[model samples]
Target: MTETVQRPTLEAVAARAGVSRATVSRVVNGGDGVREPLVERVRRAVEELGYVPNQAARSLVTKRHDAIAVVVAEPETRVFADPFFALQLRGISKELTAHDNQLVLLLTEGRDDHARVGRYLAGGHVDGALVFSLHLDDPLPGLIQRAGVPTVFGGRPGWSDGTSGVVYVDSDNRGGAREAVRHLVGLGRTRIAHITGALDQTSAVDRLDGFRDVMADVDPRLIAEGDFTPAGGERAMRELLDRCPGLDAVFAANDLTAAGALRVLREHGRRVPEDVAVVGFDDMLPVAEQTDPPLTTVRQDIEEMGRLMARLLLRGLDRLHPDEGHDPAVGAPASVVTPTTLVRRASA
Candidate 1:
């Protein structure tokens, strides 16, 4: 025995505001050509009557779902375990909410999942997408492009089809790595070793390129491959120690890897910053601050990067739907590479 409160309709709002139904529809959608007085009148009527537009009905006229898809080409385990994605999602959510848009998160695990994601994007279920494709060989970039949905990438995409432009937001990975290695060099550590992330990933490759930029003549034995995980860090560190026991420094690709290196270093009775100096990237606070002697790392604004991704996607969408109040004078959205800064701590 429940009495349901009726929702106000477009007709009710128009009658209350002494305007026609078409006029109310125009005002409620965006008020592009309507006079200010009529817009204000309709607004007052809507506020008083608690009128909410029917999204399904409105979409028919405007051709927008007011929803955005955030597609991550990663397994659920990695997405949940990494703080980087969480912080980035928070920033994206904040920006999307400010604009009254909905977020639909899509995670892909395997080829089957990639096919499903491609269909979802191509189905016209959402207005646009924000994608994260980490590896150079990941087929997601091509899949999404073929879907023909406007997309803004979380990181610089590795694959190029040459038929379309790619828009992305990313940190200065190469420059950050260079800064880290240079800092260790400033400490006068000659026998410097590096623990690189997975070479398949663009971020890892760029960071490795940056390291070589500084240590051009470094011994081949001083480099070890890591997977941007604590376990990978441990294995690489042990290998580096075994191959070059005289190494005076280690530059880990990320904070998680740095933490693992610290553990292995401790196990081997190596005193950090005394016997060897260490530096990391990402400045992930939980790992960076709690590590033994803390970690000197590069700080990239992860949350800001996420926010920028959403903003870029929305702006691009606005450009497509100029009737939704997009300014023609505003230029098309372009790729952005945010700067990275070196955060010094006790580890180095």
Candidate 2:
């Protein structure tokens, strides 16, 4: 019979490093007070033995699974196809990897999926949760909170206000939209139509509000809501064109929607920036070159929001509160607020 090689364990690592189990635990858990030489010795012995700490065992002591779940509240196709979701996902994945924590992604299916997700989180599958793509009357926030899980939202959480302890991360939607509209106004376009995102979503509502705020004082006949999808944008564009054929400018809530508007502009024989200027929010999935006159849009650092969520989740894993993670308030609340800027392209 051939001899069998043994796998490494904490005990083996401690013995090899000439330390007790307690000392080994401290070093492995990154507890303080261990001497440098000893730390190096334990690390080297770990390498030689090819020892890997058992995350399950570590959780017994740390009370954390070292995992965080990012929840997207959109249909599978939208989650899979949307460029903005991909960008957010990339940012979250990178941050979680850097912190040595596992990332769990969950998509809400419906009522049944919602119940299952609530039960799973309460069962301690992850340390915290980040949710996104909220509809107007979503009850998931209340359900998740009652499940005893620390949670955050990609944008504003829908539901009743005073969500006691929930944290969220979002961009400056209203300000960004307003700035884009203001730019169009300055360009001498008064009959401007808007391709707004879903009215229920705060991002859409806020952006639409910004447009209305300006147009209320200028022209209120140029507002229409899109479903934040290319098809929706196309449909909304058609509706707006039907009602206001004389529209000279358009602002879409997101880049894809903006691109849809661009197609309609071409079909209508309206020249961009000459007969009908177009602008979009969320500078993700750069398609400026793809547009007939290239697309000018508002840019938000969505990737940064993902990174911040990961860091916050990591902090939660370590028994740190989201607000306690940074020493100074980093212009970002525990509810991170990333900035948005106007990116001018040929479309506008």
Candidate 3:
């Protein structure tokens, strides 16, 4: 018969640290009121004894799971198809791990999943939530609000009514788009056209606004709607070419779309940066660097943005539980917009 190895208990750790069991529990649970010298002693004892706090028992005492729900609302195909979401998730996971919190990923494909997500959040399964890929008319905003869970949006949400008090993180989509369009204009490309992502998304809307800000008098025919996919980029590129054959430049919404547009442009016998200079958003490595001539695009710190989202949500959670020693006055900002820079490559 195999012998069982015993797990260290709180009492064992307390005795080793020369403190009471209650003191060991306090230090293990964030060391709120515990002094520095004692906290260090308990920590050393925990390390020496290989003590792991019973999460279920701690939750029973503190009413916190130390778990964060990351809700991604998009098609299942898009989740795996695009590298953008994956990069962001990596950042979120890294930050959450650093804080000793659990990450519960909630993927919602459509309206049917919203109710399930809402119920799960309301059921007190997690401390807070980090939601992403919000559309203009997405039902998630309302459902999340009703659930009363502390939430941090991954991007700027569309609705202003219910989101007045909500916190969010986003890149400077409008500013990045403006810089791309301006760069094209500087190259003496007057007939510049834009392929937009789904207008329902705030990032797409902001980028389109930036385009218009740079070229206020641009003809409406110069704009084409894309679904932020390669196939959508192909169709949009075809439409733009058919509508405005004289277009000398194109600004694609994302790297994937830009890659698709580049292929279409090549098929149409257009010489990039000579006949039709191109620019894309999201300096996604897989698509941008691997493009035929490489891609010149707007670079946003996508991973950093994800990390910030988790940090902000965790800060909110800390505020919710003041007993954990987090300062209520140092709450998360209402909105955080990461800067975007223009990355020059052979394509542009």
Candidate 4:
């Protein structure tokens, strides 16, 4: 049998770098409290010796797993069908990979899965969590709280009690929706309508608030509820046209919904922008650009939001390990609202 090649140990790295084993360990962990010059020396020695620290042993000493859990609470079909989650996952994965942390994905389909997720998080399998797609009355938030794991939400959570201390990242849904409505109004469209997403979601709720902000006296008959799906959008659009044939503008809560509405509008002989100006949120590439006349929509940096969520969670983890030199002030923000911009295209 061939001889097994021995791996370089911490002692070997220390000898190569001309530092004590403890110093090497400290540098390997995070280099907190170690001078810059020593850090470089240790890094160079690690490279030269191909010294890879034993993560299991290191965790035993530092009590950190260097792993993050990403919990996506949505239907499995929706997760696969929508590009939004894929883009966000790309951003989260990139940031976590850069920090040498493992990503543990937890997909929750329903109530039963929520309990399993709670148990896993409480089991101490990860250092922190990034949760997404939370609906109103979601039990995961309370479960996460009970687990005592540091977590950052992907969107504004809808909890009856105040989310005073809860940390989250979300787009300016209200502002974006307002802009979309105001743009339609600028085009002199008086009979404007709003297609709302599932009211149970905070993003959807915020968008509706923005619509109401712009159209304070909007006709109650002009509002239709959709489930943020193409099918829902199609049904809502049909219902709106039957109720208000004179409507000239519509602001869909999301791009997929907008695309569905566009299809129905075409079938009903409505010329986009000429007969009915349409605007959508999310600016999802697949639906927005592929629509017959393209689409004018609100653009939220979905990927950046995902990246920020990961970064915030990592920072929170660092703060917990004060010895790692992380600033406590990093955890001061209770929520971060990313800005949104309108992208003009043929649809509007």
Candidate 5:
């Protein structure tokens, strides 16, 4: 027969420690009412009995769920496919774990989806929220901010309202784009056509503006917008070629666009560099390096951006805000803009 085992209880511990049930309860709950010797007696009894406090009982008093939400306003396909998004997700997940906080990821795209996301954040479902991939006129951020909850941004949606005050982390796109274009110009690639990304995004718009500002002395007809898809880039490239066949080079807004242009240009018997020079952005290694002619592009810290955004949010969550405390250190949220660099390769 197995040895009879005994379970620990508050009354048993109090009896063994020569203390009242109330005193034992205080000790178990980590309260500070009892004197030192009595506290030691309670601890001894607890150790001997192997008592584990009931979590359900404890949480009822604290009212802290110790969880957070991460909202990415993009499609499920985009979230699953994009490496940059993956990096950010990992960073946010790691930081939340290190701080013992749970994370919930929400993808809010459609109008109905947007309504669900609003309730999830504003409903007191999570203690705080971190939102990313926000666009101009995106009302999700404003809704959560008005709820009086601590919110943080993954990037600045540039010209957006109220979200500007939210702490964020972003990479430098304007300078990097200018450098890529200037490099192309230096290589005697005038009549250089550009395939732009989505204009509503600041990254896309800023890159386009940088390209235009650099080429202001040149003709403006050389630019065409692509939706950052290979097909979009191919269409944009064909249109550019049809309008400006004499175009000697192209600076695409991203690697995917550049790759698409390459396919079309090759089909049209245009040689790389020798016929139509090409450069891509994002310096995404596999896409940049695998091209028939490797793509020259701009390098950005995609993973670091994710990690920094999480860190920024964690710091903000560490202590109460100005309204909750007297410390000036917690007054206003912050916005951080990271710098960009150019990585030269054979294609340009």
Candidate 6:
């Protein structure tokens, strides 16, 4: 014989608390406009009865799924390969979990996937979204905006024209790039070169701009295009060395890129920080610290950026539904640009 345990219900809680069903409902929903004493009474009753409010029934009353969709415009391979995405997701997951909200990940691989994601967002499956990995020509942002869901972007989006009220969290990419370049200059590396990440990404574009900010009127031959990957870095480094064999330093857009460049440098019989001083952005510990001679790079709080994005999105949601346990004290959500630091290592 099998036995099924019955779950405690709102009616049982109301009966135990000596309150009406309506009172219990009010308290259970959000406790908004409910007196503290009564709320405490209901809560105590709930605890005593082990009453678990049915999320499905609650959603019907509150019209909120209490779930958030995290849309990443990258394939599974790229998402899994990069530690940056994992750290960001961890931050987002922690924040959302603390708020009793569910996270639904939506990954896109191609144009067809984008359409499918757009449709899902339009279907009202979740309360809001946290979107990441946007490219300059990416149409996902536009689709999300059209879907009218509250969203917080993980990085600065590359819209052709600045759209008002677009919320995002990003590191100071340009500033970080400038610091890396200036550090190389301080080392008296006159023939400095740059290996850029994919130009399609705003982060890469901003970093490249930062390099030029310091190296104004730099030789065009010293710049090599990279894809923010070790393989891309390897290819770009070879191109830079071939084009300007006399270059004394290299500023790669990211740590992975720098690692690749370092490998190529060693292959060419150039000693790092001696023959060619190297600098990289994104002090990703696994890549930066593990590199030969380690790596001097710009450090951005990737996990913190993720947490901020979720916080901003949730705050925005609260603003929209002020009566639903929304705290008035929390300020309006705005775009945030977290600062970056240049972490010094032996490589530079």
In the range 289-326, model 2's lDDT, one tens digit per residue, is: 57667788998887888887777656655544445457
Alpha-carbon TM-score of each model against the true structure: 0.91, 0.88, 0.88, 0.87, 0.79, 0.90
lDDT score of residue 312 within candidate 6: 87
Give the TM-score (vs. native) of candidate 2: 0.88
Tens digits of per-residue lDDT for model 4, 1-348: 999789999999999999999999899878999999999999999999999988887788678899999999885475568788888888899889878789999988888998899999999888999998658878888899789998998998887344566889899999999999999999999999999998989999999999999999999999999988899899999999999999999999999899999999999999998999999999989889999889999999989998889888887676333454555455454578899999999988
lDDT for predicted candidate 5 compared with the true structure: 0.78
Model 6, TM vs. native: 0.90
Clashes per candidate, residues 3 or more apart or on different chains:
0, 0, 0, 0, 0, 0
What lDDT tens digits, residue by residue, belong to model 6 across residues 107-198?
88888898899889988889999998558888899999999988888899898344587899999999999999999999999999999998
**Candidate 1 residue lDDT tens string, 160-249:** 432348889989999999999999999998999999998887888889889999999999999999988999999999999999999999
TM-score attained by model 1: 0.91
Where is model 5 poorest over a 10-residue stretch in terms of lDDT? 319-328
What is the per-residue lDDT of model 3 for residues 76-150, given as tens digits with 9 covering 90 to 100?
476577677888999999989988788999999788999999999999989999998558888897799789998
Which sections of candidate 4 miss by over 4 Å?
1-6, 11-20, 23-49, 160-163, 319-331
Worst 10 residues of 6 by lDDT: 319-328
Instruction: List the global CA lDDT of all models.
Output: 0.90, 0.80, 0.90, 0.89, 0.78, 0.90
| Candidate whose TM-score is highest | 1
Choose 4 or 5, whichever is better by lDDT. Answer: 4
